[model samples]
Target: MASASSSIIPPPQPPRSSSYSYHVFLSFRGPDTGNRFTNHLYSALDRKGIRTYKDDKKLRIGDVISDELEKAIEESMFAIIVFSPDFATSSWCLDEVCKIIECKNKLGLQMVEVFYGVEPCDVRHQIGTFREAFQKHERKGFHESEKIQRWRDALKQVTAHSGWTSKNHPNL
Candidate 1:
């Protein structure tokens, strides 16, 4: 993974700020699970007054992630990564995951993974759909090589942490 620059990382976070702007920041591929599982999770979080951050599609502007999105991730106390089958296909999602990891490592921010129909092992090892995503990325000849490595490393790092898998109940 390439090193994140100051432009990507938000300003230095205060060491002892108990008041976070959000309770959770949800990360997922919009096309895959936005209407189904992610929407339900967002609704549940809202009902509980969790102060969650789910990107407003209307506010999204470009392929590159916006500063507002980065600030949201930094301000959130926790992050929930919904690893759907097509999650890796979108660079925006991958970049978000990378930033989530950065927050976790530097800010001691908490994160949990929900393997929504995808295997944890596949995410960790970059196999199956994950493999396909990487292949497509390589063929595109657009993304920086370092960024691609960063995405792979981010995937491995996040999957190493404790997470729930759909293996037990495929219906979920």
Candidate 2:
């Protein structure tokens, strides 16, 4: 397995200097695209020597830690969020989404969302599976009302950015 730093070629010109440890931080639901789309994308990026961070660590059943994962996000030049069917269902994934948006806002970290077999409208509006996920989150009440609202805002804010869909950008 190639560590993010292992490279056959230099990374493309990003806005940042060599202070960045990785070119991209990949955020996704493991079960949805881990073995398929995200995996393939990571592999392709690796082939191109684009230093990328994909969380392969098994997570504990707690809030997404602000240590390694957060550090990786901060260290990367940009992020690619793979919004799949069940992405919104996981609190951890939603948490990461919030953190990614935070980084984008505060650190000027760029992000490009990829709607993988999902609709950007659905994500932005919280319709379809996304709607269901939020309903479940509300019913569970595991998170504070304010935290949930932040997640909602993050979703809306993120989807506002121009991105590629599997249907339109089939080449990826």
Q: For each candidate, C-alpha RMSD in Å?
A: 8.3, 5.0
Model 2 has a clash total of 0
- Name the best candidate (by lDDT): 2
Tens-place lDDT per residue, model 2, 88-149, is 99998898899999988888788888888899999999999999999999999856889989
| Model 2 CA lDDT for position 3 | 38
* Candidate 1: clashing pairs of residues: none
Worst 10 residues of 1 by lDDT: 1-10
Off by over 4 Å in 1: 1-16, 57-65
Task: Please list the residue runs of candidate 2 whose C-alpha ends up more than 4 Å from where it truly belongs after superposition.
Answer: 1-18, 57-65, 169-172
Candidate 1 yields a Cα-based lDDT of 0.80
Compute each candidate's TM-score over C-alphas: 0.84, 0.84
